[model samples]
Target: MRVTADLDLCQGHQMCQVEAPAVFGTDPDTDQVVVLDEHPDPALRPQVDAAVKYCPAMALAVTD
Candidate 1:
């Protein structure tokens, strides 16, 4: 699976980072959502999906 985040759509809520720190984080300067990995392991897909679901701004997307 692949994950992507629209920086423009992000409100810096940090839910994704909170849910999966290994795959997501916030820029220290801009505080925008940063995708640490686009193609994560299958084992991590669920967490990624959860992050996407929890994004209030709908900035996250997953493609499998």
Candidate 2:
């Protein structure tokens, strides 16, 4: 699946980073979510989905 992060909506909560570090990260300079991998391995879908679901700002999304 493919992951997407809306920086404008991101609050830098770092939940995504915690759930899926390989797919998401934090931008120290901007304190926003960074899409480390727009497209991640399918095996990582559960973690990615958790990140998206837990994002307080609802800035994360996933698509197949």
Model 2: per-residue Cα lDDT at residue 12 = 82
Q: How high is each candidate's TM-score?
A: 0.95, 0.96
What does candidate 2's lDDT look like per residue over 14-47, in tens digits?
9999999999988899999989898898999999
For model 2 the TM-score comes to 0.96
What's the distance in Å from true for residue 21, model 2?
0.7
Listed per model in order, the count of residue pairs whose N, CA or C atoms clash below 3 Å is 0, 0
lDDT of 1 at 47: 89
Q: CA lDDT of 42 in candidate 1? A: 88
Model 1 per-residue lDDT tens digits across residues 1-64 = 8899998899999999988888998999998999999898889887898999999999999998
